[model samples]
Target: MTAPAPSEKALVPFVSVENMMRLVHHIGIERVLTELTDVIEADFRRWELFDKTPRVASHSREGVIELMPTSDGEIYSFKYVNGHPKNMAEGLQTVTAFGLLADVSTGYPVLLTEMTLLTALRTAATSAMAARHLAPKGATTMAMIGNGAQAEFQALAMKAVLGITHVRLFDIDPKATEKTRRNLEGSGLTVMACETSQAAIEGAQIITTCTADKQYATILTDNMVGAGVHINAIGGDCPGKTELHRDILSRAETFVEYPPQTRIEGEIQQMAPDYPVTELWQVVTGQAAGRRDEKQITLFDSVGFAIEDFSALRYVRDRVRGTAFFQSVDLIADPDDPRDLFGMLQRAKD
Candidate 1:
């Protein structure tokens, strides 16, 4: 027996992974990244308006699962995401996610979408946006250490948003580096695969680290980092998973999305609780300084904040409207009578 479709009020737009890929192809990936960067930056400029809180996390021996929630008073957004570093060994993704946006007025969901791909896009865009303010002027080369699923997106975002012309790629696994290099074929940027992390960052002005390790491991030593470089360290998004050495952080001027959250999950977790750091939002709004001198070493310790996910959801919602890129799902229950839930259930069996 076929069931009748739900009412219009019950339908919510849902963007599947396939549809998300289609939408990305339709709008063009570079354009999407650029637009997302702008949207996230605009949201950061108005950061004071948003309700901010640390993501609720459930930690395990394997990895972490989290619910990141935030709202701008009008629209509320939340993401359900998981990170398991060992999943790759078991032929699964290290990170996977989905998110929802709801209208605060009526508490009904407006949009639901897969966020695994969108997260990569937004994280890369956020990195590029921070580099725009913190990286050295006319920076061209970026050393991408830990070339994994996020490697290509980070490279393309830097290319599209910051005009980076070269990417030096290195990974602990040679195959991973090759994968990134091959995916970037004809991307118009020079791709160089290096044997060592040190070789990768040789002449690069911007260095990004995104490894999928679930422990305290140092991917970048203090001596490996040099002056006048922007370090986008995004791998350390949990309690003990950090990439850079503590000495490196001591010498660098670290910027973060939210101090309270960053202290719990970002690279700066290695530092003291009272360690002085600038907020990226403040830098975006010109309330704080970024890259004060040529010799400055700037670090963006990104732990993937909720507001960033909010902005990404907001961007997707606006783009998917009235398009074939999303399908309507009956996410809400709409009874013929507003107060007749039992009656509606009783009628369902007929």
Candidate 2:
């Protein structure tokens, strides 16, 4: 019997976590942060150009897993992220993520990358992007409420985008704070470890809350907040997880990435339906105002939108090409005969 001919396959690029780190290293984290901020801001300004959706989440006894999908008419991107607050005790990150970028025209994946690190980068970039328009002018000091893997990225992005030179850190775990400080060394920012949340926020122009708790924990109380402060609330990004007191949200002029999603996931989740919040895209596009007065309290309730990940994948795809590090894998099969779906089974059996 004649052997079956070799099957044809389409080559797709696969980027591992190590390759992604090398790519970021080669491009320089500061440059990547700047470029990602630009990409996300541009995407936000033209918000009507893309297809958007809230992430689909699967809940388990331990935590939750989520799939966030979005498309820009040309490129499609989605991220798979799991939030297991218990994972840290197992020597794992509280969140582990991966994502794909595909050609919308062909419905074929062009790149697959580990998003664990990318998530941290884009989250920080998004926060800084929002702060650029919402934070007070000449903001110099920032308070980081939670020191985890994301803490250093927030510090770097704020320093690069907002000219923040002083970072005050606080975390439930002293080791987490130490890790943040060590990672931020030589970044030209002064790092201070604070004893409590209030100590961290004292005299800070921008306050970022990126805790990993999966419940309603008030990391920032209304009393601790002062006037003219921009709050980047990043941790309370799901239902049942809230960092700011309801009164703090009621008192401040709040801005969010996507109002509908933020209503369910951000600190505003604790507020009434008509609590009155501004969309960050509107502020970026100049369709609405940001920080109306110098003394007005501004809050950016960030839930990590799909558009930001879309922009991040696009940026990485553009930069990783022509580099020697990426490997090609066949994630999808391309049969020469489109009707040969059953043939795949026969070949496997043979």
The number of the candidate with the highest lDDT is 1
lDDT of 1 by residue, 28-127 (tens): 9999999999999999999999999999999888888999999999999999999998899999998999999999999999999999999999999999
Residue pairs in collision within model 2: none
Q: What 10-residue stretch in candidate 2 is worst by lDDT? A: 1-10
| Sliding window of 10 residues with minimal summed lDDT for model 1 | 1-10
Backbone clash tally (model 1): 0
True-structure Cα RMSD, model 1: 1.0
Please give each candidate's TM-score.
Answer: 0.98, 0.94
Per-residue C-alpha lDDT of model 2 across residues 1-350, encoded as one tens digit per residue: 44344443466777899999999899889888888899999999988788888899998989889999999899899999999999989998888899999999989889888899999999999999999999999999999999988899999999888889999999988888998998889999999999899999988999999888888898888899988899898885778899889888888999988888999988888888998988889999999999888899999989998999998888888888999657887677665676886775466566
- Candidate 1 clashing pairs? none
Clashes of 2: 0
